[model samples]
Target: MSLGYFSYPMPVNEPVLQYAPGSVEKAALKKTLAELKKKQTEVPMYIGGKAIKTGKKVRMHPPHEIEHTLGFYHEGEEKHVKQAIDAALKARQSWAALPWEDRAHIFLKAADLIATKYRTYMNGTTMLGQSKNAYQAEIDSACEIIDFLRFNVHFLSEIYKQQPISSPGMHNRTEWRPLEGFVLAVTPFNFTAIGGNLPTSAAMCGNVVVWKPAHTQVYSAQMFMRILKEAGLPDGVINLIYVDGPVLGKVCFSHPDFAGVHFTGSTGVFNQMWKTIGENIANYKSYPRIVGETGGKDFVMVHKSADADVVATALARGAFEFQGQKCSAASRAYLPSNIAEEVKARLVAQVQSMKMGTVEDFSNFINAVIDERSFDKISSYIDNAKKDKKAKILVGGNYNKTEGYFIEPTVIETKDPKYVTMCEEIFGPVLTLYVYDADKFEETLALVDGTSSYALTGSIIAQDRDAVILATEKLRYAAGNFYINDKPTGAVVGQQPFGGARASGTNDKAGSMLNLFRWLSARTVKETFNPPTGYHYPFLKES
Candidate 1:
């Protein structure tokens, strides 16, 4: 386990389980989810290895079943933010001074724990709290999180092993130093994996973190901290808090020791934070690094030569998986008019076969959107599309939230490519499609580019080699993660690093070396072997 001066280890993507009927994974997930559903507990705010409870509380409920209470979290105030930041700063010196190998050992152990010991519990909590089905929960809460930990461990070593090339007379070295102060990780609620990754990656790189996960994700976020603690993460290294966004921002952004922010949320919130940082730039000891991944208006373009079944399957899975909550999910599409009907028929059948209900049901593929707010926003879009003259509800467009925040997988076909649904980021299980004349393939590509400001994820499905090559070259900047004959969703950890350009994000591809670079500052060192050190250079000699 301890062999190497410098070498790159191949990072493996954690294999996803099928969780089929009567399989071990299915049985384990079902058993754990039922146990969690019956238990109502209080989630505490952890700071410096201690759990502090506040009187004010936020009751937690499953997004799919609103009536059922999963748990309650201790709502933190402004005081907690300061305390967390202080806690992180206090732990900074010892954590950063530790050897890189020692730090790598802790995170590698964490990866093993998540992949083996805590897999079922984490997946079950994600399914119940976040409304992800068995398969979805397994891929996100268990597999992806494990991959992040393992790959980051390797990457951390890679960073340390990197040194500047030295000349014959002098030796030069580069040090990747952690920031002088604490890091703040503001994570989203969609993927429990990202929620874990935002904080852990920075902490693994020897930076102390003040992690504030989205309130809706606290149920699993609590479990995430538990696993990290069990895996031997030290006290005060990562101070976990649950405070209001404004309160947290006001304090953290204004603090002198606020070094950086690892954020994955809405563009509006990110932009506001960016402005605040700029306004308070003079207050910080060092320049703060802002790394974020925001909104996406992803698309799927189908050429005439595509396989109808493949195109339909891709749409069904890409647009409807996790209720289309991924930032990379396909929200719009362009199809050739000649084969539109054939593709539509197959797509409708695939959508019709999906079951929308609670995550406990193994047959159910579509679950509820995150909560009431999301449910309302998505329903309004569907309703508005129904009233539009150029739009038609081709297959599914039904919604009921009495029992749970349920919205059926909806498909809106519109004659106008500029329809609101086609351009906007709905972040729901709704797909808007426009069928174009087969000859206007190039023109349609231009429409896709100009349609939305967010350039996140997209796919081009074509059997013809020429069409595939043309689309690849033409729409290079359109998507950060572009697919060929496949769906835009499900970007893997190592193989297909994910992010986008434009309004989508800063395009710092997570799970890659580039993302890690943002958390580091480089310093070059030089030492001369000879004692003839003089300020004058050889070039100063006169002939």
Candidate 2:
């Protein structure tokens, strides 16, 4: 059926576009945003390549402007989850049997579509639905998602080429088969790229997927599903559904054919899923592969010789961008006493300068958190800090929810190194600072490593080469993705494959070949060119 060995060259990362004032991209994005706000559309679940609409509809609203209606999506019940699984199993064999090059081109076409025709729609939907600013939306919904698609195709192709060596008398080869059954992709709302990558990565590996995105992210998620269909993805290959997490898990986890899950969410939820899967291990055909990137209490540590401006800028962008909703957002900082005063002054000024409002205004660097529940959770931490005597507000501790859930970028200075905000993850626009003696760099590194159970991401900013080396070795396991002089966030796809370990996650390193390997099962084939008359080995007959 196949002629020659195929090679897909390594792909370069997609370039991020700047939506500057008076630029063509800026005008196009603004027009797209305006159009999206004016229309209210109805969305349905895609199962087995058919659009299925249940009467139960949930309204969609923008986080920054809750009053405005974006659209409504049909919500499904337990029966629908079962239906999705059945459809996936029905389509699994045909899809897995198709040539790998054909599968690779479908996703490659989808990436090109995102980069060109539907670029604005992707960015616009993300900006409005997720309350992300123009640049954030461009980087996430457009560039990052594009990079994930292209790079994954190349990575999976490279995986197929790996083979075992053979001796003179025999020829050996390996067949990389897709997992036996279906994969479940549970994605979060913060990044549209994560929502796209979770499902497509597994599907690109010849696995059928049952995708359930966060309710808050359905607006953009549906757009991507339509794009996949247009890119020649067959029906039932990736079934999109809307249902409660418990109900979805009840059906998928207990099913005998459930093969794996690709997840991105909170730690508690991931823990519960693992527990349920373990409890139901006897029902499955094979051991399920569970890969997840959970929560992060990411940090930034400044050395005595660090530049004050660099430290200030890193905190400003890392802590406040996307309203600090990123799992990798810098939630805590350890500033040495030598440069503490200057860094504090500069950071306070930067925080004060930020304008918070809707995502339509490109000038506003801060936007609303995801929803009311997230808003309440983030604000409660700030309220508790106001009452505690050990902590004082450095700047920006105000919040309002009249028109939108807007919380100013709040910074807290604490005398206690182990304060609640420092240790716990408050996924919001809040940063807590703890200053230590300049001579206690090593001691503070230990404190930083010991403070949080999460080791997802952290940065060490310093001009002293020795200080950088010291932090690098001492805190080797402190973070899965470590940074120097730069912010802890903004990991590029091929250059920096992202994921973490400990309570953070399994650290499978998504956006790399390592993640793709989880979706495959290999079978080795060995053929003997010549046969002997007797069914006996040389050692048994000769000596």
Candidate 3:
């Protein structure tokens, strides 16, 4: 059956007796909420110039609860990945030949289309498909994607216009241009924004892309392609392939025509792909570019002078947002001993008050973890933490896998700051709490740095100006994103560039000029009004 957009009932009409003293305000709010809930759809994948119902099928269930099968989609196989790759390669010559301005038009129109018809669909998919709550799915993931597409279009134009001279007298100049081949974009399930940016950046730079989206978010990625097609993107310009990772990895590494790769996933997978490409490098016509954002062990530091309330709230969102699947999630939090109890109280209160349910309800604050594997991993981690002499499970450590993948938002307190959990990338709604003596601020900073193999994100909370400045400068190498008063995961498009270095992989800095550069190459073309005399060029032939 063809799937229409996903829709849910409005969260209106509370029990009259339970309704607060503000009846007039409540009535008005319900009216607006109803209108918004009415607009949503579940879109399908579009590949090779058209939307296709796959030969094989897989049932998609709500990440929150597995009782009801939300929908089933065509399970793309090895053949589909190759077909998509061929489509991308087939269209490359013509697409890359288009003027830069024309290429920019597709992205600009895509942004507008996304801001319109795709918004509700995108939000609904995030909720049901990825286990994100309504507000978090719609407002954060979907909105940020639209904003990224718009801002990146303008940035690409600016990059094109920049010209610097190589010499004063000679008619020599350098120009940045697109790589004249295909880019294979392998994305993650964490954020919708990264999904759009990974492949679209290459498309914006006049390169056709074969994009393999995360299985959990195939629908979200499909809707993205739909918006671009609606925006008048040329057929075959950007191909969407829905195959499993290992199969797609083979095609990407083996294809001699492939020019670049933009990947976001685990460090293990990234290294394997890199090795595969290296093995095939000699046979390829050109040196293929690899850009990636892998795993992270993000941290949050609380100074003695910081407000406990703010730290609690920030840590709540940082550790629990999208159930902590984000690369920038605060996996480890360090607080001063003086404020530890107060911060713990506030965090416990907030978490306890939050509602937990599936996306269909649209009223819950917490939703499902991703799948059975993720649920198992997180639950096992919590179990293992119990065996550690220095570890204690603080708030939640519950897991329910009889249905969909569900894990309670858990917090663990460790006696030693260097506990193994504090050093690793849990990549779930699991937060490790560490308390340090106030005087050992520097020592605590070094502790986090030493423990983590990843340097993707780290933040320090402090009211003092000097403290904030010192933290920023001292921990410069610690994070691609560093937060002060706000949460770390919500990095805006134009303002903050995302990604990191060290084991976190390439610091491409998505949504900034740095990432746009990765999709492009350079060229020089000169036409001298007066032709130079034959022999001598620069220092050659005895000038």
Candidate-wise lDDT, in order: 0.90, 0.94, 0.77
TM-score, one value per model: 0.97, 0.99, 0.89
Per-residue alpha-carbon lDDT of model 1 for 1-543, expressed as tens digits?
A: 445564438678888999877789878878888899999979999999899899788999999899999989999999999999988998899998877777777777877887888888899889988999988888899888988888887787787788889889899999898887999999999999999988988888789999999999999999989888887888999988999899999999999999999999999999999999999999999999998999999999999899989999999999999999999888999989988999899999889999989999888899999989999999999999889898999888899999899999999999999999998899999999899999999988888888999989999999999999999988899999999999899877877887888988888888877788888888899998985857898889996
Worst 10 residues of 3 by lDDT: 10-19
Per-residue lDDT of model 3, residues 1-543, tens digit only: 214422222122111122134554234334433443454334344666977677576776667667666556676777777788788778878887776666666776776665555556666666666877655665455567776677777777677667766454457655676775689998888787788888888888888888888888875677677778888788888888777888887777788787889999999999998999999998677898899999999989888899999999999998898888889898899989989999999998887776777665545677888888888788889999878889988788887877677777889999888787898788898999998998888777777667877889888899978778878888888887888866677676667788899889899988777888988888877756666678756777563
- Candidate 2, poorest ten consecutive residues by summed lDDT: 534-543
TM-score of 3: 0.89
> Candidate 1's error at 133, in angstroms?
0.3
Q: On lDDT, who's better, 1 or 2?
A: 2
Q: In terms of lDDT, which candidate is strongest? A: 2
TM-score ranking, best first = 2, 1, 3
Candidate 2 global lDDT: 0.94
Clashing pairs in 3: 5-41, 5-42, 6-41, 6-42, 66-404
Q: By lDDT, highest first, what's the ranking?
A: 2, 1, 3
User: Which numbered prediction scores highest in TM-score against the true structure?
Assistant: 2
Candidate 1 local lDDT, residue 133: 91
